[model samples]
Target: MLKIKHFFLVIFVLIFINCSKDEPVDSQETKPLVSAIDIGNSELPYIKIKTISSVLNEPKIAGEMEIYINQKRVLNSTIGIEYRGSTSYRISDKKSFGIETRDASGKGKDVSILGFPAEEDWILTGDVFQAPNTIFDRTLMYHYLGYELFRNMGNYSSRSKFVEVELNGVYIGIYVLMEKLKRGPDRINIESLIAADTDAAKITGGYILKIDKTSGSDVLGTHPLSYYDTNWDDDCRYTEFNSFRSNYDINRNRIAFPAYGAPYHSNKYLETYFVYDYPKAETINAAQKAYIKNYVNDFETALLTDNFSTNTRTYTNYIDRKSFIDFFIINELAGNIDGYRLSTYMHKARGGKLKMGPIWDLNIGYGTGGRVPVNDWIINYNNYVTNDAWMVPFWWKRLMEDPQFRSELKSRWTELRTNTLSTPKVLELTTNTSNYLTNNNAIIRNYTKWTGINYNYNNSVTELKTYLTNRLAWMDSKIASF
Candidate 1:
């Protein structure tokens, strides 16, 4: 009887061990899948986009996006995503995207994402992408730095947040989710100009103009505007319905293009065109167009013909001097290679002076060379790169020539260096941003998936800090002379 009981106890132990084999063990280590190595969960916000047709090649593609922050679902919304940027699009496999959040009926829906004010249009700008442009912003902090500095100066720069992105279940890498520059109460904060506002009081005021290459609608080939008056002004690339040319050359002389049309002559760099940005090329009416064109023309005329012999300056009547001063300081601070030429924006408000602000596109900035002296003013770009397609406008160069303007600029620069833009402060911002990315393992994950660029994340951050240090010092010495 004792032998039979012992045998039964052994059989019961065997049955218990067999049952435990099929159940999960809390102590056992589980290896992650192969894809999880590159695209695993992390501390940064994760934006996953699933397209309806699994394609995002065109300018606009229907999709649904879900954002997760620390593994918790924050937003799920329908969206229209599109490849954005002209040069950035052509240069990288990981393209920037313009996202418009939508409702079920496919109309733009306003919803707050990442705690920013509710707005439909947003942009996801990636860092360097897969381009071999080694000098490009691999540090991924230039845009944020430039915009933040401008905002600190009491200007309205685009608000941005860093986030990781995945499209169609494939991790694309880190992107700066930013607000698009547009006319809104929370954005540029300018009065709107619609098609019917053709009267004297309504038409005399608001307009947003940019000096940029013909893109977006030009690439889409859908602008309803007519060709510019080519009979007199032979720059046929411009259309009377959309743009107007500067009355003076870069040297502040009468306007004259050496040759006309697209693929313009080398001398075309001397000429500038103000493209209609707000009302758009298609919707801006004849009366409204004439009003803004004349206003800008008047401002230029007063600036160019000014004697500067007295305090009663006529140009001051047209422009807000403080805005121009701040804009100049911000661009000079960043060493923006494209500062006054490409991606430049100027706007006017109802019954207000023409203002230069809401600075855009600082990707290729922060000590990037543009054939100019490292310590020189970016507005003097033409003094170096003589034959570039886009040249710095005469506005800044002329403004610097004015004693009052120089005094104002010097005062502003001095105030900024004391606190907001001091070397230690700027370095702190850069270091903090880098630490956030590093602590979350985002830099490693981003570079792992978007390889071949050979980006040195740590070194890039170090170099950025060094550049800012030197740049701020140089600017300090130069602005002192002003």
Candidate 2:
């Protein structure tokens, strides 16, 4: 009887020990233990993951990560979880894993895949814009948003991606890996083809020749004129020939046209491209001058013919008219400032064919800063008072000196303001954009902290009205002089 009882006790003790060994260890030990066990296993790579989700309790295990090993799904075993906020799993016998995080609402976030030798999967090339001596990870968020905005606007910009991994148990925003583009030929060079005059044949031949020369080549073409060329005005001449000649120096190329918030004159870099290879020989004689005058007239006429509907003809000449009208409509509908200057370069480049392009550099417009406080004020001052306004009266007085042009301009402005104010699509897109109230609040908070202005709606309206009225009065006097 004593021997049977001892045998039963020993069997019970062995079973209890086996059960304890099979049970999962505490959460704290799971991470290190799994990591240690998986080390040099040479079978499957272990992955440490931190997930952000709208649902799911802290340290919860994801039922099925739906992992793929080298694009093949891992079907046999379950993944383990650790830490309240992050999870870790030993993915033994797998080359890659595709991870998808799904919320309680049944929406699946995009799947991210990881494999052995992670760095081999991601590659970056070119002259990445980086601040020296700083880790690329430190400024990822800002650079990402900045580059994204610039690219979305259709400007020549760069590309970026992110890379990160964990060591122990900490979260980090890692390096922003970037690939650089070799500089391409300037758009100005292409524009020169328009002057060659042999209809489709000459134009096609010019482009084909250029492509052949540049095929598989990294070098930029030489400009037609040097900086010291006699055709340039004293203020416009490039003092340093070598520095000003390069296509990569945007300041020297200044291809960016005049837009709201930017200075009125052509950028210095742009001036080089504009003046280089300009047909100074053709313009030196009276016949050439006459030809240029005719060319300018034809350019203006073409713009009017192409862009203006029969009803919109009167306002066609002023480059920013549509942009200004759009701005006023948006501001009135949203009760906030979000409009900015549509660039003058669009009209200048297309000979008035195209109307608008992507809005750039909105840091200031919409009751933001500068001496002007309102859209109406900008229109009134630019139309009437400024020496360099694009409106008819300003252009007529300075360049055209024709009374008919001024009258036509006034008529156009009156018609446009009335039409734009009545458009519903204009009203809806402006008013329905999200976060206006929040953005306005943020703006007010920032201004109050910095400038101590009480930036309420009434105050904004009052200030805008006062500035516009004053500028209008000033414009009336200037028009009278014209």
Models 1 onward score TM values of 0.86, 0.27
Model 2 alpha-carbon drift over 4 Å, by segment: 1-343, 347-400, 421-435, 438-482
Off by over 4 Å in 1: 1-41, 54-58, 130-135, 217-236, 257-260, 452-455
lDDT of 2 by residue, 1-482 (tens): 99999999999977644422211223343332232121221212223343333212222334322221222333212222221100001111101122223333323332223322111111111111122221111111333333343343234333444332222333111223332221113221223333434443322211111100110101111222122122223222222221112121211122344322222243332221111122222223333223333433443444334432233443344344443333232222222222222111121232232222222222223333344444333433333323321221112112123344445444533454343322342233223321232232332332233234543434443443443344334433444453
Lowest-sum lDDT 10-residue window in model 1: 223-232
Q: How does residue 412 of candidate 1 score in lDDT?
A: 85
Q: How many backbone clashes does candidate 1 have?
A: 0
Candidate 2: C-alpha RMSD to true structure equals 20.7
Give Cα distance to truth, residue 364, candidate 1, Å. 1.1
lDDT per residue as tens, model 1, 1-482: 99999999999978644432211212233222222234455777778787867444354678877776765666777788877665665566777888988776668888788889999999998865554444367777788888888888788999998998888868887899999988899998888899988888888667888887655422232322222112212222555666888878888898755433464555678888888888788888999888888888899999988987777689999999999988888888788888889888889988888999778888777776457666788888988888777899898888887888988888988998899998888899899999888778888877767774445789889877888898888988888887
Cα misplacement distance, residue 146 of candidate 2 (Å): 22
By lDDT, the best candidate is 1
